[model samples]
Target: MRFVNDRDPLPLIEQLRRRYQDQRQIAYVERAGDAVVIDFTVHPAAATQGCGGANGTGCGCSGG
Candidate 1:
């Protein structure tokens, strides 16, 4: 598991869901009384966006 910020260079959860182009997982949380209900989606690819890493972020894809 990982945490991402709104400004992260990687991508938004929504974006990743789209780019994967395959079965993906999504985590979400909801409030129920005093407890939080965590939920997940088994598939997200069909709803994700095509980023291509696609924007050439200069992260050095070769694992620098």
Candidate 2:
């Protein structure tokens, strides 16, 4: 996920950790003028479960 805002990213990261049960990690960050962009990557297993279509069964959308 990408967060575009002027505020610090720590709060956002904390919030995401709580939301995703600490399965999220910060991949990187970029600065765009006054806004900061935060990129995150969730654990593979968590991603698959969150997608709700494991093996392309439910939503017909593969998480792979």
TM-scores of all predicted structures: 0.28, 0.49
Worst 10 residues of 1 by lDDT: 50-59
lDDT, residue 39, model 2? 80
Candidate 1 per-residue lDDT over residues 1-64, each given as its tens digit? 4333334232565676555433446554544454444344434442343222423343343532
RMSD of each: 8.6, 6.4
List clashing residue pairs in candidate 1: 17-48, 18-48, 18-49
Q: Distance (Å) between predicted and true CA of 29, model 2?
A: 1.7
lDDT of 2 at 13: 70
- lDDT to native, each model: 0.42, 0.62
